[model samples]
Structure formats: C-alpha cells, structure tokens
Target: MEWIIGIGVCAVLVVIFTIVTYNKLVSLKNRFQNAFAQIDVQLTRRYDLIPNLVETAKAYMTHERETLEAVIAARNQASSGLRKAAADPGNPEAMKALAVAEQGLGGMLGRFMALSESYPQLQASENMKQLSEELSSTENRVAFARQAYNDAVMTYNVKREQFPANIVASQFRFTAAALLEIEDQAKRQVPKVSFS
Candidate 1:
C-alpha cells in the first residue's frame, strides 16, 4: 500500500513539472513575437518616409533621375523583405533576407544623400529638411525596436535550451529564434596616397 502512494506522488510531481515548463516556454515565445511586432511597426513607418524624401528631392534633382530610381528600387526590395520577415520573424532565412535587403537600401540612401550635397538648392529646401528630420527620427526608433526584439529572442532561446526545459521544449518542438541584425553597408576601399 505504501509503494502505491509513493508511485502516485511521483506521477503527480512529473505532471506538474511538465505543465509549468510548457507554460513558461509559451510565455517566452509570445514575448518575442510581441517584440517583433514593434519592429514591424517602426520599419513600416521608415518605409513610408522614404517616398516623401525621394519626392521632395525630385523637384531639385532633375538630371539625377537614375540615382533616384535606384533608391526607389532598393526601397521596394526592402519592403518585400519586410513582408517575408514579418511572416516568420524567427526563421533564420527570412531574417537573413531582411538584413541583406535593409543593408542594400541603406547603401542606396547613403549615395543619394551624398549626391544631394552637390545641389545647394535641394539641400536648402524646407521640404527636404523636414523629410530628412523625420527619416532620422525613424531610424532611431528602428534601432530601439531591433534591440528589444533581439533581447527577447535571446531570453527565449536560453530558456528553451536550459536543462529540464530542454526536454519539454524538444518534445513540444520549440525552435530557436534567429536574431535580426541590420548592419551598415560595407564601404569602398580607400585609394593609396603616393607622394613621389
């Protein structure tokens, strides 16, 4: 009779542990999902600002139509990437594609800004100044959102990998989430200076 009681108690404890572990994992995953949503919102705002910036610059940059067109193309590619990443924020491949697209867009925008420097009238336009300010503000917001998302992902991944949680996570098929890192585009090599 004592052995029967012991077996019942052990079974109860095992069930309780499994339930708790599953709940914790679910909570962690949801947190990261929410974080990703914040990033999406900010990125959408950033993408929206791109067109206004391009349009304002258009009034002054008549001869630089090709550069303007390239910027638009990069923006479109980045937008497409956002859709894919939003569909599966934790997927490694989706996140990588988004990062690459963003990097390309950044490079294009950098070139656009450099070219605009040659046109004093464009640089001094009130509309251009306003759009530039908004873009700069949006960039800051994106950086913050990305940091929050990465932090949440790190927490979720650690929890999923820990001892007993690992057992439950595997059984329940909890996959590791990838980090979203949007790095700056690589710069061109500097020319060597020769003094003969």
Candidate 2:
C-alpha cells in the first residue's frame, strides 16, 4: 500500500514538472514574437516614409534619377524581405535575406543623402527638412526596436537551452531563432575623424 502511494506521488510530480517547463517555453516564445512585431511596426513606418522622402528630393535631384530609382527598388526589396521574416522569425534564411535587403537599402539611402548635400536647394526646402527629420526619427525607433528584439531573443534562447528546459525544448521542437544582423562592413566601420 505504501509503495503504491509513493509511486503515485512521483508520477504526479513528474507531470507537474513537465507542465511547468512547457509553460515557460511557451511564455518565452510569445515574448520573442511580441518583440519581432515591434520591429515590424517600425519597418512598416520606414517603408511608408521612404516614398515621401524620395518625392521631396526628386524635384531638386532631377540629375540623380538613377540614385532615386535605386533607393525605391531597394526599399521594395526590403519590404518584401521584412514580410517574409516576420512570417517566420525563426527561419535563418528568411532573416538573412531581410538583413541583406536592409543593408542594401541603407547603402542606397546613404548615397541619396550624400548626393543631397551637394544640392543646396533640396537641403533648404521645408518639405525635405521635415521628411529628413521624420526619417531620422524613424531610424532611431527602428534601432531601439531591433535592440529590444535582440535582447528578448537572447533571453528566450538562454532559457530554451538551459538544462531541464533544454530537455523540454528538444521534446517539443522549440527551435532557436535568428538574430537581426548587419551584413554591411561599411555600416559596421567607424567613421574616421580628423580634428585638424
């Protein structure tokens, strides 16, 4: 009789433990999903802002038509990549595609900004100024969102990989997610400064 009671208690404890671990994994996954959604919102805002910025600069940047078109094309590609990544944030290939697309868009935007510097009329325009300010603000928001997403991902990954949780994770097929990375060496490099 005592042996039967002991066996039942052990079985109940094991079931409880499994349930707790599974719930924890689910919670962490949800947090990661929420963080990615924030990134998506910021990226969507950026995509919408690009057209206005391009239009504002177009009047004064008539000679730079190719640059303008390149920016638009890059923006479209990034938008598509973002959609794919958001659909499956855990897919490394999709994340890499989005990262590359974003890098290309950044490069194109950098070139457009550099070219605008040579056009005094574009720089002085009120519409351009407003659009530039908005874009800068949106970029900052995107950076913050990315940082938050990365942090959440790191935490979730750590939890998923820890000893007992790892057992549950493997049994449940809780795959790891990819981080948003910058693939551009130029973007990673620090700008050279000269005081002289």
Candidate 3:
C-alpha cells in the first residue's frame, strides 16, 4: 500500500514538473516573438520613409539616377526579406537572407548619403533636411529594437540550452533563434570625428 502511494506521488510530481517546464518555454518563445514584432514595426517605418527621402533627393540628384534606383531595389529586397523572417523568426536561413538584404540596403543608403553631400542644393533643401532627420530618428529606434530583440533571443536561448530545460526543449523542438546582426564590416566600424 505504501509503495502504491509513493509511485502515485512520484508520477504526479513528474507531470507537474513537465507542465512547468513547458509553460516556461512557451513564455520565452512568446517574448521572442514580441521583441521581433517591435523590430518589424521599426523596419516598416523605415520602408515607408525611404520613398519620401528618395523623392526629395531626386529633384536635385538628376545625375544620380542609378544610385537612386539601386536604393529602391535594395529597399524592396530588404522589405521582402523582412516579411519572410517575420513569418519564422527562428529559421536560420530566413534570418540570414534578411541580414544580407539589410546590409545591402544599408550600403546603398550610405553611398547615397555620401553622394548627397556633394550636392549643396539637395543638402540645403528644407524637405531633404526634414526627411534626413526623420530617417536618422527611425534608424535610432530600429537600433534599439534590434538590441531588445537580440537580448530576448539570448535569454530564451540560454533557457533552452540549460540542463533540464534542454531536455524539454529538445523534446518539444524549440529551436534557437538567430540574432539580427549587421553583416557589413563598414557599418560595424566606428565613425571618426574631428573637432578641428
């Protein structure tokens, strides 16, 4: 009789433990999704701003048609990649594609900005100034959102890899998510400043 009671108690404890672990994994995964959603919102804002910036610069940048077109193309590709990644944030391939596309878009935008500096009319335009400021603000917000997403992914991954949780994660197929990274070395470098 005592043996039967001991067996029942052990079984109940095991079931309770499993339930708790599963719930924890679900919560962490949901947190990752929420963080990624924030990134998506910022990216969408960026996509919307790109057209206005391009249009404002077009009037003064008639000679830079190729550069403008490249920017638009890159933006379109990045937007598509973003949609795919948002559908499955944990997919390594989707994440890689998005990273690559974003890097290309960043490179194109950087080149366009550098070229814009040579055009005084474009640089001095009120519309251009306002668009530039807005873009800069959106970039900052995107950076913050990416940081938060990466932090959440790190936390969730750590939990998934930890001892008992690892067993549960494997059983439930909780894959680790890839961090959204700036793949361009140029972008990673700190800009030099001169006060003179």
Candidate 4:
C-alpha cells in the first residue's frame, strides 16, 4: 500500500514538472514573437517613408530614372521579405531572405543619397530634409527593436535547450529560433541620410 502511494506521488510530480516546462517554453515563445512584432512596426514605417522620399527626389532627379527605379524595386523586394519574416520571424530561411533584401535596399538607398548630393536643389528641398530625418529616426528604432528581438530569441533558445526543458521542448515540438543578423559585411552599414 505504501509503495502504491509512492508511485502515485512520483507520477504526479513528473506531470507537474512537464506542465511547468511546457508553460515556460510557451511564455518565452510568446515573448520573442512580441519582440518581432515591434521590429515589424518600425520596418513598416521605414518602408512607407521610402516612396515619399523617392517622389520628392523624382522632381529634382529627372535624369536619374534608373537609380530611382532601382530603389523602388529594392523597396518592393524588402517589403515582400518583411511580410515573410513577420509571418514566422525566426524561421532561418525567412530571416535570411529578409537580411539579404534589406542589404539590397540599403545599397540602393546609399546610391540614391550619393546621387542626390549632386543636385543642390534636391539637397535644399524642405520635403527631402523632413523625409531624411524621419528615415534616420526609423532606422534607430529598427536597431533597437532588432536588438530586443535577438535578446529574446537568445533567451528562449537557451531555455529551450536546457536539460529537463529540452526534454519537454522536444516532446512539444518547440523549434529553435534564428537570430536576425546581417549577412553581408558591406551591407552591415546603414545608409547615411544627410540633407545638409
């Protein structure tokens, strides 16, 4: 009779442990997802600002059609990549695609800015100045959001990989999360937007 009671108690404890681990994994997953959402908001804001900047420059850069078009194309690709990553923020392939697309966009924007410097009228335009300020602000916000997301992902991943928690994670099919890192060395630099 005592052995029966001991068995029952052990079983209950095992169940409780499993439940706790599962709940923790879920909570961490949710936290990282929320972090990704913050990044999404900032990137969305950045994407929205691109077209306005392009339009403002279009007036002053009549001969720079190819560069303008390239910028728009890169923006569209980056937008698509953002949608994919937002759907599953830490999926390896999706995050990789987002990073590449972002790199392309950054390159195009840099070229556009360098060209814009040639047009004195475009540099002095009030609309261009305002857009540059907003883009710079959005870039800072994105950097913060990305750091928060990476931190959350690292925490969640470490928790998921821990001994007893790893057992529960595998049982529950909790996948590993990927970090959002820039792939290219040159692309690591954010475009310098100066309207001064």
Compare the candidates by lDDT and give the number of the best one. Answer: 4
lDDT of 3 by residue, 2-45 (tens): 99999999999988987898899899889988999998999999
* TM-scores for every candidate against the unseen true structure: 0.92, 0.94, 0.94, 0.92
Model 2 regions more than 4 Å off: 183-187, 193-196
RMSD per prediction, one decimal? 2.9, 1.5, 2.0, 4.2
| Residue 41 error, candidate 3, Å | 0.5
For each candidate, the alpha-carbon lDDT, in order, equals: 0.92, 0.91, 0.92, 0.94
Clash number for each model: 0, 0, 0, 0
Pairs in steric clash, model 3: none
Candidate 2 residue 170 C-alpha distance from true site, Å: 1.1
Any runs in candidate 4 off by more than 4 Å, and if so which?
183-196
Per-residue lDDT tens digits for candidate 4, residues 60-111, read 9999999999999999999999999999988989999999999899889889
lDDT of 1 by residue, 1-196 (tens): 9999999999999899999999999999999989999989998998999988999989899999999999999999999999998998888999999999999999999999999999999999988999899999988999999999999999999999999899999999999999998887354556679999
Clashing pairs in 1: none
* Superposition TM-score, candidate 3 onto the true structure: 0.94
lDDT for model 3 comes to: 0.92
Q: On a 0 to 100 scale, what is the lDDT of residue 109 in model 2?
A: 92
